[model samples]
Target: MALGMNRDVFITCAVTGAGDTAGRSAKVPVTPEEIAAASIEAAEAGAAVAHIHVRDPVTKQGSRDLALYRETVRLIRASGVDVILNLTAGMGGDLTLGSVEAPLPPSAVGTDMVGATERLAHVAELLPEICTLDCGTMNFGEGDYVMTNTPAMLKAMAAQIKALGVRPEIEIFDTGHLVLAQWLEKQGLLDGPVLVQLCMGIPWGAPDDIGTLMAMVNNLPKDWIFSAFSIGRNQLPYAALAALAGGNVRVGLEDNLWLGKGVLASNGDLVAAAKTTLTSMGAKVLTAAETREKLQLKKRV
Candidate 1:
C-alpha cells in the first residue's frame, strides 16, 4: 500500500564468509589479519557494523576456531576503529547427509555438526557486541548439505548468548525461520529488542524478488529491528531497497564479490558503493555510535 522509509539507516558489512569464495576472489580475506584489516576498511568506507566469519588461515576455508576469532577481534580493537563487532555463531551446524544407496551415516567430509554449547564457544569466549543465530535448519545449497539448527539447539544458543550479553542477529532465510524466531522470543529464551537479518537470494532459502522481500518485511515484528540483503548482483540494489523498506542495510564481499560485472571488489569498495546508493536515495546512514544507540546494544563484554 504505502512506501516504507527511514530518514536514518545503518550499514552492516559482512566481511569474509565461510563459503567457498576464497579461490574465486583473491580479495576474500582468509586469515584473521586480513579479515580484521578488511573490516576496518569497511568501517572507514561507512559500515557501522562488521559481521565477520573467520577462515582457517592454512586451508582458507571457514573455521570455528576460538583462537582465530580471538585474534580477529583483538586486531580490530587494536586498530582503534569504532566499528561494531558482529561475530558469526553460524558455524558448527553444517551437515552433508549420505547418498541414497548407503544413507546409514551422513558424510563426514562436510558435516561439522556439534552440540549447541560447542557451537557458541567462540561467541561466549569473544563476547562480540552482536552474533548471528540462524533461526532454523534448511537445505542450504548444492549437494546433500543442510544447515542444521533445531528449536532445541536455537533455544540453547539464544539463552547462552543472552547470558553473554551479546545481541543475537537472527539470520532469517525463509519465512518459517521468522516464525521460529518469534517463537523463541515468546518463550523468553530471547529477550529485549531483537535484530533480524533477512537473508535472501541463497539457494534453498528465500528468493530475491520484490514480492518476497516485501512479504518478509510485512511479517516483521512491530518493534523488532531488521536489515535485509541479497547476494551477488542484487547486493548493491538491496542496500537502497532495504532502506526504502524501512530497515537497515548490509553489504560486503560476504554476499558478493564484484564492484562491476567484470570487476572484483574489496570490502571497502562494496561498502562505499552501498553508501553512495543509500545517500542518493536521501537516507542518512548512521555511524557506529548512532547504530549502537538505535539497537540499544550493551557495552562490549
Candidate 2:
C-alpha cells in the first residue's frame, strides 16, 4: 500500500470532552454558553468542525441532558458560526465498576449505561452533521472505568444514526475497534465515505507511537476518511503527523490543555496552533463547506 500526505486537511476541534478536566484547567469550557463561545472561537481560528460534549453547569460534570445539548446547539447556531457540528454519542456508555473484586453492581458515580435509543437521543433531536460512535469497549484509563461500547450497542447506534441522516464518526480507540468498524460496515450500518477518528494515547487503548498509528492507518478501509489525534502534549505534534499520514487532524482543550510549558490553551489557541503547524508544512486547511462537501456531510441549522 503506497502512502502519501493529505494536502487538504480539515481540523476537528473537540471543544470539551467528558473528562473531569473542567477544574484542572480554567480554559476548559463548562457551561453551554462557554462551550458555544469556545466552538465559535475555534471556528474563527480555523477549525472546520467542533466536536462537542455538554456539561452540567452546577457540577461541571459531563451530562447527557437533552436540554444541555439543545441549549449548546442553539447558542452555536444563533452565533451564526459556520462550522460543522459533531456531537458526541459516546457519553451514555461509560461503565465504572465498583472494584476489581466487587464489580457486579457497578458504581453509580460513573456507570451510565443506557439503551441505544436513549444514547442517540440527542443525535436524533439535534441532527448534527456528525456524531461519534465509539467502535468498541475497552478499559478506559485508571480504575474500573471502562468506556463500554459493545458490538450490539454499536450496531444499534449506527443504524439509528444512519436512519437519522447524520454522519457517524467512527471513533477507534484500539486496533480491534477498526475490526468492529469493518463489521459494522459489513452489516450495512456505516454508509459510504465512512468517517473514522483514530483516538490515540488514551490509556488501555492504542498508544500514540508512530508505529501503532501507522498500523491503524494502514489497516483502515481504503476509501474511509479518517482523522488522527493524541491526547496531552502530543496533540499539536500529531496534527502534522496526521496530515503526513494521509488523514485529517483533531486538536482541542478536550484532548489537551497546555499550549506550551506552563501555558494553558483554549480551544481557539489549539486550533490556531494546529493550523499554523499544518500550513507551515504546506498543507491547506479546509473550511467547513469544503469539509462538508468532501465528507458528504448533511449540515443542519
Candidate 3:
C-alpha cells in the first residue's frame, strides 16, 4: 500500500437512517418517493453513491419491508443519475430489554430481531452494489436497547452477503469491531481490498476525537478500501480528515440533520458541502463511474 494519497475520492450520501428522526424535521424524507428523490438530488450535487434505508409511510418509522426496499431501488435506478445504490443491511437487530429487572420478553413492540439471512433478505433480492455489515454490537444510547450481533451471526451474514456478490462495507463503530472485521478477513469471508466504514461519534461507540480515528485507521489492512464519518458537527470535518487519511467520505441526513446551527439540510446540501471541503484541500471528487472502478464495484443491471 502506498502512503501517497489518491487525489480522486468517492463521496457516499446516506439518504435517511433507521432512527427516530423523521418527526424532528419534515426535511427528512419518509416515503420511498421522497427518499429516492433526495438520493437523486444528492447524486446530482456530487455524491457517487447513495446509501439507503426505508421507512413505513404511515408511521414514518424505520422498516425493513422488502417491497419498500424494492421500490426505492427502482426509483433511484429509473432516475438515471448514475449513482451506486448501497442498501442498509443494518436493520432488524434492535433489542429493547424490559425494565432492567424483567428483561426476558424484551419490549415486544419496538424490538425486532431475526436471523442473519432474514436481515439480508432485501439485500439478496435488490442486489445492490454495496450493503452494510455492522461488525459488532454495542449499547446504543441511555436506553435499555442493545444492538445484538454475535460472532456467529456476523460470520453467517458475511458468507451470505459474499455469496450474493454484494460488497459488504464493514461498519466499525469501535476499535474492537475492527479486530473482529480483520478476523472475518482472515477467515476468508471478506475478500481483498475490503471496504470499511468507520462510524464515529455515536453515543457509547467510538469517540470523534483525532487519536481514536487514527488508531482505528492504523489498524486497518493496508490494501483495504475505507471511509469514515462522524455524527453532528464533526461530520464535515471528518470528510476532510478522511481525504487526508487516504479514504472516502460519507455524509447526509443519516449522521447529521443541519448544514449549520438552526439550518436544516437536504441530502444535496450535505454532499455538496463535503465536495467543497475536499476540493479545497486539493482532493478531486470521484464520479460514479470512477468510484465503481476504484472500489471494484459491479454495475447492477
Candidate 4:
C-alpha cells in the first residue's frame, strides 16, 4: 500500500452546532448535560477534539444563552476527559431577513445579531482551548437568514480571542473566507501557526467538490494547520479525502447524522467511523495531546 501524503491526522468531533438540526436527529444532544456527555464520548471514540454549540433545552433550537455555555463547558471539564474543547464563537450572528421587499427590518423571529463583543461573551467567560471565528458572512440555509460576520466584527472578536489566549479555528466556508482569514493573519489579529476548518457543501457556501477543496488548500498559508469536512453523506468520505490532501479531518453529528444508510449516528459513532477510515488509509489518528501541541493551544485553567 502506498503511504498517504500525510501519515498522521487529528479528528475533531463537532458535537452539536447552532443549527436547527435537533429536530431531524433524535440523537443530537440538546441540553448542557447531554452535550458534555456526548463530547466526552466522542473523545473516547478517538476524536482529538470536540467542537460544541449549545441549544435551548426546551425548544431544541440553537441558543446563545451564556449560562448554557458555562454549564456545558463545566460539565466537560469536570468529566476528567483529556479531549480538547472547542466552543463556538460563531453564535449571535444569525441574520434572518423578513422579506426581500422589506429587508429594511430584519426578521426578529430567528435573527440573533448583536455587537461583536456580546457575541463573544460565552467564549470570553469559558475560555476553552479553541473557538471558531467564521471568517466571512453569507446566506446560510433555505431561509432568508444569513450567517453574519463582517471583517470589522471578525477583527473585534479575533482581538478578544488573542487577549483571552484562545485559538481561533478560522472557518472557511468558501474560497473568499480563506482570503479573509489570510488578511486577518497579515493584520496581526491572528496568531500562528494558524488553525482553519474548511466548512464545505453548505448552501451559498463552497460546494463539496475535490476541485474546490484543493483550490482552498492551495491558497492556505504553508505553516497553517487545517481540517476539512463536508456535510451530510460526504462527511465520512471527506475524512480520508482531507488526509490525502494533507489536512486533518472533522466529523460529528453536528455536520452529519448517519453512520450508514438507515443508521442514525451518535457523536461517538461518527467519530469512530472517521477514525476507522483514516487508519485504513495508513494514517495514524492523532490523540488530543498531539492535536494541542500541533495547534499550539493555550489551556485555560
Question: Which candidate ranks first by lDDT, i.e. highest?
Answer: 2
Error of 4 at 48 (Å): 1.0
lDDT per residue for candidate 4 within 109-212, as digits (tens), equals 87888998898899888889999999998987676988899999999999999998899999999888999998999999999989999998999999999888
Residue pairs in collision within model 4 = none
Clashes (backbone N, CA, C under 3 Å), per candidate, total: 0, 0, 0, 0
**Model 4, TM vs. native:** 0.97
lDDT of 3 by residue, 177-216 (tens): 9999989999999965799999999999999798888888
Give the TM-score comparing model 2 with the true structure, all chains together: 0.99
Q: Which candidate model has the greater TM-score, 2 or 4?
A: 2
* Candidate 4 segments exceeding 4 Å error: 1-4
**Overall local distance difference test of candidate 2:** 0.94
Q: Return whichever of 2 and 4 wins on lDDT.
A: 2
Q: Write the per-residue lDDT of candidate 2 for residues 171-267, one digit (tens) a residue.
A: 9999999999999999899988999999999999999999999999999878999999999989999999999999999999899999999999999
Give TM-scores for every candidate, taking all chains together and pairing residue i with residue i: 0.98, 0.99, 0.97, 0.97
In candidate 3, how many clashes are counted?
0
* Every candidate's lDDT: 0.91, 0.94, 0.91, 0.89
